[model samples]
Target: MSNILVVDDESSVLSAFQDLLGSGGHTVATARRAEAALELLKADPFDLVVMDICLLGMDGLEALRRIKEQQPTLPVIVMTGHGTMQTAIEATKLGAFDYHLKPFDPAEMLAAIDKALESTRLSRSQVVLDPETTAAVAGDAIIGRSPGMQQVYMAIGRVAATEATVLIRGESGTGKELVARAIHQHSRRAARPLLVVNCVAIPDTLLESELFGYERGAFTGATARKTGKLEHASGGTVFLDEIGDVSLGIQAKVLRVLQERCFERLGGKETVHVDVRVLAATNRDLEEAIAEGTFREDLYHRLNVVTIHVPPLRERREDIPRLVDYFLERYARELNTDKPPVAPDAHRLLQESLWPGNVRQLAHCIQRALIFTRGYPIQAGDLPLPGEVGSDRAAVSGLGDQGLGELVRRYLATYTGDRAHEAFIEQAEKLLISEALRRAGGNQTHAARLLGLSRPTLHAKIQKHKLHADTDRQAR
Candidate 1:
């Protein structure tokens, strides 16, 4: 039998939890306050912790942080009566396994306990990380060596392969969906279906039926029985994109599914049980939505068992070259052509500019440049950054509010001779090689990586261009 700790200020709650969990073939330890709970935790090894948010001495969230600091891998389930968005977000961020409202169903509580224990057991079963690759790739979706991206990769590694609910937060175009996919692809449910639901795209009228399905004759246009995305995602994952936009009513239904593991379809009397893990993403501030009463606090806590924040592209400038290389290769393959090298000035300009739309905008910008280039290296003038700044300054300087595409077309139309093209290509390649070598501090391996070239190929190019390797020591 597993040992469980239940911490609550209310004596009655502690007793009730002890009795309920004790009857289910588990040993239950009760603590009336957070301080006592911590002491008990230090004194003994418990399989799981169920603590109240509104504790007597130290609050549950603070206690949670301390507990995690001491034992990060320990699963903590927080309970609360004053369910607020701020409290839920703070608890989840502090590493709570799950959160439940005070009047939660006993069956739901037991199920949550079971799930947490099962997940914890699975996490310890074997080494999840591949020793050779964990320090390198970390995870499949993440593609950078920056400290910020490394943290993201580690988070994915820790939570994937378990049934923990995950919440990914990031600005638009930061590859949140890619992170979700990586988690699913690496999970035990990898063989099962992974369903995606864009919470903001569907109308409120149809969202419920779309997620929970609808029986025939439930509403107008409901001519046949339809299964919802959630049902179809059984034994798998449901990626809820833009989950901050989910309505309060829908949030309540989602909370029920998280709690009871079952839901009744629209106009259906029978309940359907699902073995689904939820991975939610949003660019919106859910804390503000909760304060505005638009988002439910309980639902936030449930989905945010493990939170992964994806830093925007501007925040991790060092990873830009890698991302640029990846996107350029992808688009080049699609276009059936050799990828053009980015000019040194263009690469530097890209690193210095602010990408408001994040990686997605950068990808599009690269594609647009590729389409416009006539077999020459992409120049600084080719990048279509908005706001008349940096790389885009000269392109839009005299255009007087003209669109980026228009300016790009005008710029491309100026390329007249194949001789000029060859000269431009030669000059651009030399400059790019020099810049890459400089960035790599004269390391050929690093320079090749920066330029998306093989070391041998880069060595050949260096010889062809008659460039010195000790360029990093030279003044810019």
Candidate 2:
């Protein structure tokens, strides 16, 4: 459970937050004005603070500035019945974790609060680089002693304290974000917010408005002025993940930020200035994108000021055993079970296999292996690796015109329980969805397209099968 402070002039707002957060297993403290909230903050440390913009005395923006000054790491969620573009930008510029309009959905509010709290945790928790330590350490740590990893550490050390833009290049699941986080945590802007913008996850149509705030009536359905991530992350750091996937238009805007440190909001006349560091990561070959005219050459030059290449797991096979041990201990603690011993053959298989998905895939494999082992020693057969005989990949490979009939026959022959028809259908759907997600690199939109289903429908099916739990981290 976490401790939260809610500041609002209205008794109903405080009471609502009390009941809402209380039921979520959090200890709630209420205050009528910003003054009381600041006092409470000084008296005790809270995980998060929720405050209204229109307070009795000092307004939310002023209170937010004071709060940030007092505790730069503390996350504050600002809400108001009357919200404007200026107010939203000011709140974010003042270091508010999020800006929410009043009468917000409870589920959305809770989700935002959870994310803010997590962001606080990450900002506060130091990312340790201690490969020599044999014991498992809590929080995020970059555990590797390989030469390539050593170079990565050196690069982070060299550029972290500077304000130069850094481009981190690596394959998927190679801990690029972790490297970014490490840089931010060690940088001068460590006390400020670190906003992550995923280029691939957000659609191209909406990506511009997401990076640059949109003015009221900027486009259809844009009823209210919205603060963009770049403006909101002022005086801090913005980590752009999957940077190669961004469109040329968006890339030009981002280049302008890196060059001039200013941008005009969508459908707005005045240019807004911001002070923030940019760290970008990408798995795609951006040089190729530039050649193909999909990515801007000028933007690429701006982002490539200091390049840090994160070696994939396959390239640094020496780190696999250490990674395996660290994950085993970490996940064991999470599972509330003792770490199970891995057979020598199992370890050998893991080290020898080509990790196409990199570290994230290996972690998932270990997690699934642990679940399957169920307190027993892990054997080679327990690892549900791709391309194994009778595995999903093996079953689906080289399917011709008779593929559908063969798949149905396989399912029918394997399923022995009652309600076989329903079971078969569900299992088939799960496999198809999972495979599509895997092939799409956990991109739900792309996966949806591949499956010939709407994005929402694909999302519902993913939730039904709980596939996201396994893929979300990988996607990141």
Candidate 3:
């Protein structure tokens, strides 16, 4: 059993974590203040640390900063009594092993500790397994230990030692860049930079300059000779995201870069050459594009030198629980609270969903649910799932333009265009929060789940919308 330190100001929090972890067959220590935790750190070696953000003295963030300053490699899990994105982001920036929102489950926290410990162990030993090596080579994170991910890992291993340009095909939100990154990380040029360019995000007119760089005065806006991502990744890797979205012209230029390993900068006569590994990812079917003549046949063949098609989320439903567990653990750390276990019903509901948005969407959904549930053990009843609730209309109603999605646009329009119901937005959030709670039978976690709001966020909204009283069984 590894020694773990649990720190928080509240005696109840300290006692809870100690009991939770102690019961899990791990050696656990407790400290109510950051200063005490730091002293304990100096005295002995701890495999992992469980810290709180809002401490009595020096605070968690500052204490973390000091801890990192002294031991950069030590993994510190920052647990916040309150769930705040700002705090979580700051903790991540500070290199905390992970952050968790308070009121979190003990089991999830232990899982995070295990993963963080593993990351630390791996980083220290530098003896990454074949799978991890492949994941590093592919530029995508190898998230699961399942058979599908293992195959992806093996593929990366096989192709990493080679120089062939790779075409990664997968549905949206499958982490193609992660695969790209893994390739770069495992390749001979692992130390070199891995540059990325999103082919679809930029305008066609500017893509040439962006990819190939441009000489001074190449265009009206081109004031200085600039190097592009291709040149920047000269000795490293270049990732082209959304490869299928590129126009024929851009595809032709990319083809030239791949085939000849040389391209002239825009308005520059001299040809620039770079020895870079190319990794391309796209969600669309390149064969369909080839048939439609939207994508070049030769270029597709060039990139398809070592094809790696990622399976969609649905096909790998077995990995859902794993992914869900992984993400919930990560988000709980992000929320700076204790990690929460997902209810079996919620897990099944999540598995049953089509997940049309894929992994990214799933991540978003889990995050929303975690926040809503306020780091409690999540359940199907807690989810803002469309079909689960008896009243879909009631749950979706008051979402601004009749849905939560349109609220952003409505807010933007209100701010940028004619003045409108700015006041209504707050009221809508209140009504929505109330309705979500009502549908969830006044279960805080269920209510948050119904609204797809985070615990801290839902808590704040409840207070903001003044729905706390209305939704409460007893008056506050």
* lDDT digits (tens) for residues 1-476 of candidate 2: 89999999999988999999999899999999899889999999899999999988788889998998988878888999998777886887787877788888898789878867876776777788855764658776788999999999999999999999999999889999899999998899998878888877788677888788788789996666666778767888999998887666788889999999999989888788999899999887788666656678888899999999999998999999999988888788888788899999899889888787789988999999988787688899988786553344445554633787787778778777779988878987999898998898787778865765544456657788888633453334
lDDT of candidate 3 at residue 269, scale 0 to 100: 89
* Candidate 2 residue spans exceeding 4 A from truth: 22-26, 82-90, 103-111, 134-136, 387-476
User: Number of clashes in every candidate structure?
Assistant: 0, 0, 37
RMSD of 3: 18.6
Candidate 3's TM-score reads: 0.54
Please report the candidate that would top lDDT against the real structure.
Answer: 2
Per-residue CA lDDT of model 1 for 1-476, tens digit only, reads: 78999888888898898889888899999888889899999999987899998977799889998998786556788888887756765775566766677687788678768866764543333322222332233223345778888898899889997889999999878988878877877788765556677775565566898788777679886544455667656666788888776666788889999999889889888787877899999887778667656678889899889999999998999988887877676677667778799999999878888787888988899888888884469999998877444535555454645664574456568865667668656877998899998888887656865765534456667988999885333212
User: What TM-score does each of the candidates earn?
Assistant: 0.54, 0.80, 0.54
State the weakest 10-residue window (summed lDDT) of model 3: 131-140
How much lDDT does candidate 2 score? Answer: 0.83
Ranking by lDDT: 2, 1, 3
The per-residue C-alpha lDDT of model 3 at residue 122 equals: 31
> In candidate 2, what residue range of length 10 has the lowest lDDT sum?
389-398
